[model samples]
Target: MKFCLKHGRCNCVEFYQGDLAAQADAPYILEADYKTWLDVIAGKLQPIPAMVLGKIKVKKGSFSVLAQYVTASLAMIKAAQKVGIQ
Candidate 1:
């Protein structure tokens, strides 16, 4: 699955549930196991730590972009918490 958080908004702008090859191009592609994502959304794991711990994976993207979007990314995570994914 692919989730695109657009324009630095908390709301999910789009998502693709099929093979990534069929999805629209994105600057970043974050890949992780279900539990890893749950922990992130639940605030049990910070992204940096998770990355250091090898929980989260970036299949595509540039760290520079991620650094620039850090604030927006965190806000997006906080927004995801409202979805009750766990």
Candidate 2:
């Protein structure tokens, strides 16, 4: 059941948490919306620990490649925050 903050409307939804089968009777939600919600819940807990922090030897190149990972991570964080997650 989904609770509508506007009014005391408690939607008796058949969905359980994030189950698709339960959401079958619910309205169609966008994929982006789902992803953000998941990320927020995940963020509330501890981050993933690195199994191994071995720095692999890389070929001689500029350090710009590291920038790509940083940018993508920031974008993901922003998108997650856009949703009601934290």
User: Which pairs clash in model 1?
Assistant: none
Candidate 2, 3-74: lDDT as tens digits: 222233333433344445345433322222444345434554211111012121212233345334444434
Candidate 1 regions exceeding 4 Å error are 1-7, 10-12, 16-24
Clashing pairs in 2: none
List TM-scores for all candidates, in order: 0.71, 0.23
Per-residue alpha-carbon lDDT of model 1 for 1-86, expressed as tens digits?
A: 44555564334455654365345577777677778878888888887667656686666777556766567767768877987783
Q: In angstroms, how far off is 67's CA in candidate 1? A: 2.7
